[model samples]
Target chain A: MARGHPAGPTGPAIRRAFDLLDLFTTARPRLTLSQLARHGGVPLSTAHRLVAELVRWGALERDPDGSYHIGLRLWELGALAPRGQGLREIALPFLEDLSQISRENVQLAVREGAELVFVERIAGTGAVPVFTRVGGRFALTATGVGLVLLAHAPTEIQDDVLGGRIERYTERTVTDPARLRRMLADVRTNGFSISDRQVTTDSLSVGAPIHDHLGQVVAAVSLVVRHGTASPHTLAPLVRTSARAISHALARRR
Target chain B: MARGHPAGPTGPAIRRAFDLLDLFTTARPRLTLSQLARHGGVPLSTAHRLVAELVRWGALERDPDGSYHIGLRLWELGALAPRGQGLREIALPFLEDLSQISRENVQLAVREGAELVFVERIAGTGAVPVFTRVGGRFALTATGVGLVLLAHAPTEIQDDVLGGRIERYTERTVTDPARLRRMLADVRTNGFSISDRQVTTDSLSVGAPIHDHLGQVVAAVSLVVRHGTASPHTLAPLVRTSARAISHALARRR
Candidate 1:
């Protein structure tokens, strides 16, 4: 109730704290206090107090150079997320096996709204280079995993993705809604999706859906290789088998 | 201004929100609203409002069974943590190489206060089963990585760890402070540390420190194998090489 005591409506403070956290990203993982305050649209004094509290709670860490970063404690808490590490941990072995056999990049992803979040990725020996990173997000119309997720996604979500301006990463990227709809239909009919140089010029990926115990398509798995190195038809069954193995593992866990 | 609103001391509310988050751990990754209220020691109405805010911000998610879980957004945010995924991303390729070469469990860890947190782990085929999870915490006196981290830690931290109650996981675990002190000294002098069945009677681990550009030990890497299958002297050099490779990669990044 005291004035000028860093006391106010709890909602704004909590939102501001999270806003400060959101300023950190893959491109800019570290920031000074002044930068945080400026980017978060808060006063220096308020940012100072909030940063202190976050540091005390181990949500933020101060580096030796006087910059702030997301702390290890947050990583520990995030590891408990079922859609993230929980799913990755279950699928990692099968993915590793697939990557070993195919010697290509294998990825696990799940739908989040109109986009997809990569849960895990295993880079195989001498595999084609991909820009995807673990915990990163991508449009649901580019990558193989994204296509599989979008195909099985609810109708509203599919419409939202198709109706939005789709990013064209390469010339082969299908941005037309009619063509994409047919691609989704093929994915459903064949239980697999092929993204031929959709995300990159020299790479192709085949993806398959992972069903949970209730047979809901909760996640997707994919294998990416050099465009000319492997045939999509040959790779689809491998990716589909790996996805089924992961689905069975998930079903057994519950 | 307004009475009977959710307005309160922002500090207490922030602390209470984090407290609610802390209640969800590896053992209990999901909680109902009532359970969160009971465990977090808050009123049911307060918990409801806070949970709603958290869910709106994507910090928590509601499962179909009505349990709240840590959300994917937290995992995305946590990926920016320098001590957690940042370190792991740079060290993973080398850890994978070591895992392949040794055909044993490879682990990466960093010290947090008096404990060490596993940053990354690569499980090798047919290796001895170890009880370490990524983002999980462990003592600073048991595993090889723990000993290396404690040896390079500040003197105050070393004293705090040595002076506290050390856990004895197996009969082979050395609980004597004097002996542990000697082990720490050896780790500093030999550029590596070895734990002979300290955590598990069936396995042995060798660890080496990974330094930053400043030559300060920032993390540790380890390899674990089944007891009597290999010599620690042979494994020490491999782990030390992998650690140095990772440290060099880290230094090159900045």
Candidate 2:
């Protein structure tokens, strides 16, 4: 379950089946039988058997080109995940309001272990381009939403991320452990976060945490814009208000 | 997986595993072990073992309340499905425009077997509330989008549907095979479909087909408004234009 690696030591048959699925990513959505056999560590015969079962089960789909990808059945199962589309459905209207008001990019994210997975993203017309896809994972250090999530995460998770080598995306990205810790603390105290050109040179983002009824920070919402076009102070109130609205919606639902 | 059954007979283990997954739906996203054992038609011990493996592989998550539901990792895998979120991503902007202009519920759907699965739905502000959920399935005979997709489906699929039982949702639903066949042919000739109060007495919808680069009808887009508020004639151009725009987006991406 760690990125491209197979799931930890289950029986080989189950592990092999999951490994074939784990081989797919946003960058590589399709795989040939040989690719599955080679990368998934199964023989061609075994790969064929497993794939036959998977396709029949609707876990994988065969294209007209004879390549395989994840199927609509898996997507239906995914929509039931509360942290995924369930949360996105409840948050979308508020995200739309923020996007329309700012005419910029809006994002919703949740922490999955020490990493963050984008749950939803909306880019306004003529907004600065952002490289984000729903269900894609990112490091805990670089982006505004990432920082806010890391700030509000459990202590064990914070320790795990802070104790590791931080991946930097741009020169403005804070890599030093002590400095990054200070930034997280600022996020908690200031009730928001600002990542200025941390992920990309032209982009800066302001993020705020979304809370559940229990007051746990279940998610984060952010606004990303061209760095020189807007100040973080100007965007902070907007992002914070939207995040609060989403949190209230979630609370009411719960 | 006919609505609510176990996956086909592959081997007991794999079929049981998939059956456990297929147990989830929008109406029932969470389940206890007893529920899984009973509904999934597996022994309690087998269900527990399968649930463990599924949880380890991130296909299911155990909630704090001791119930299990679909997990975010599955969502990550689902995002790779070209027919699901991948298609939704390309069509969303067009759907958004249509929703805003018409101030009605806009939907995108694709055929999965003889059934239609909704890929995306955007509800307009002040719009009549709709019950459709993303990734949820519906009969191909019920809605405007369903009729459009069923019309373009393969000959065998059409025969299979026409030869079987068609469930009617409202008094306006056309249940006779000949009438339904004529309606489909009209859809092909007119390049759009109108379902007047078929799914619900208060709702009427207009649907148009979306094609891939090869000109195959890969999806359908529709706009649903209150039956008394707007005629399908008034909505056809908007739905068709939006569907065409989405088709162009898919073509360009391909």
Candidate 3:
């Protein structure tokens, strides 16, 4: 027998459920029933039934204000993702060491398909604030971690990003496809990437690739500092060393 | 029209989908199709269809060895959960400080219904191996963080746990309902709790409650050490101070 339907007719239902979940992103963490209905392209009554099931299963929770947000159960399941929590767990000690020693913002992120998602970020008390959140997505052409990940991404993803709209964060952000392409090549050659006053005028980040046992560039680690206080070159070796240490640790894990 | 089913009969089908997700726990992170079928008590064909849909939506991923594991997208969605990542983000700095200071295991957790779920845990280089995992659940009667959370839980949840089976972890684990009731009272009175060799024979933990702006115990922070290395008295004040700092930080977050 087939799974749900003998003729596989329930495909649309499963897609609709995913569509409902996809409607809840970082930009829209909470949604009202009507908002969910509108965004999911479903009628209010349909949205109501889906939301009820999601809430019961702990995929979503109702706030005191009656708005709905993602629940702890989803987060727990997410922690089992090898690319997300698994990578972060192995790299945490190294990231902590970098954060403590440099007293700067240390971030760990990985490429998921074409986009980059922050897996973990440790903010130093006095460090310059950079706009990044764990599980948050950002353009692949604008940040240090992004550049390293984009550089190591497959050819198609690189082409897709470089071939599309590259949003400029600051005057220093590389929006030109040709120049960004050169920068990615530089990352490959230099073994590190730098975003100097790119994402934000006050911040500069140095990033390096973290490889898995199979030698795949599974993630990137970075140290962001106040631009005027330190040069990217001075920070490159430190970030690279930490990334290597993380890679070594990951290689040892079963 | 109803959500998945315009006829309103798809409620059980949607719920069965979630029940499948719930079967993936920390102890059983990956499962074969047969295992999921058996655990979910669904027909093998139904399990396969649902699993395929979930995998297609990126809620689940197949390992290279053909086993299924939670996917990165689910982790990304989980990151939006306020009780999980939200609390972890706020408490990370203090947890880092505690870990650095004592070179021990520092953990932050929150109560979800009747169970305590670990949100963040930082292990010292020399710290003893801990059983807790990020996004993992444990009984509310065995560990320091659990004790602190259980003490502050609502009346009904407290009664339900007191009325339920209290699994024993070690000889020192307090399994008697009457004794646990007194311990909960003591936690409220003393502003902290201790679990000496409760979860493991060679570990000791001290935990303190972290309150929200509403003065509710929203989370708990704890430090676990080798049993003979530190006295609970010496650790109590530190844990309490850290918890208070986190509470104050949480209060400042709109």
State which candidate has the highest TM-score.
1
| Positional deviation of residue B12's Cα in model 3 after best superposition, in angstroms | 2.9
True contacts kept of 2: 0.78
- In model 2, the clashing pairs are none
> In each prediction, how many residue pairs overlap at the backbone (N, C-alpha, C within less than 3 A)?
0, 0, 2
Q: Write model 2 residue lDDT over A1-254, tens digit each, in one string.
A: 55565535535466568879999988889999999999987878778988988998999999889999999988888888999998998999999999999999999999999999999999887988999878888998989999999999988999999999899888888999899999999999999999999999999999999999988998999999998999999999999999999999999986
Tens-digit per-residue lDDT, B191-220, candidate 3: 999999999999999999999988999899
Question: Docking quality tier of candidate 3?
Answer: medium
Arrange candidates, best lDDT first.
Answer: 1, 2, 3
Compared with the true structure, the alpha-carbon lDDT of candidate 3 equals: 0.88
| Better by DockQ, candidate 2 or 1 | 1
**What overall lDDT goes with each candidate model?**
0.92, 0.91, 0.88
Best by lDDT: 1
Residue B124 error, candidate 1, Å? 3.1
Tens-digit lDDT string for candidate 3 (A1-254)? 55543443334566687678888877788889899999878878778988888887888899767899998988888887888888887888789889999999999988877788999899986999877888988878878899999999989999998888888879888898999999999999999999988888888899999998888898999999998989899999999999999989999985
Give stretches of model 2 more than 4 Å off.
Answer: A1-10, B1-10, B228-231
Candidate 1 matches the true fold with a TM-score of 0.94
Q: Residue A215 of candidate 3: its Cα lDDT?
A: 88
Candidate number that wins on lDDT, 1 or 3: 1
Output the lDDT of residue A186, model 1.
95
Please give each candidate's TM-score.
Answer: 0.94, 0.92, 0.86
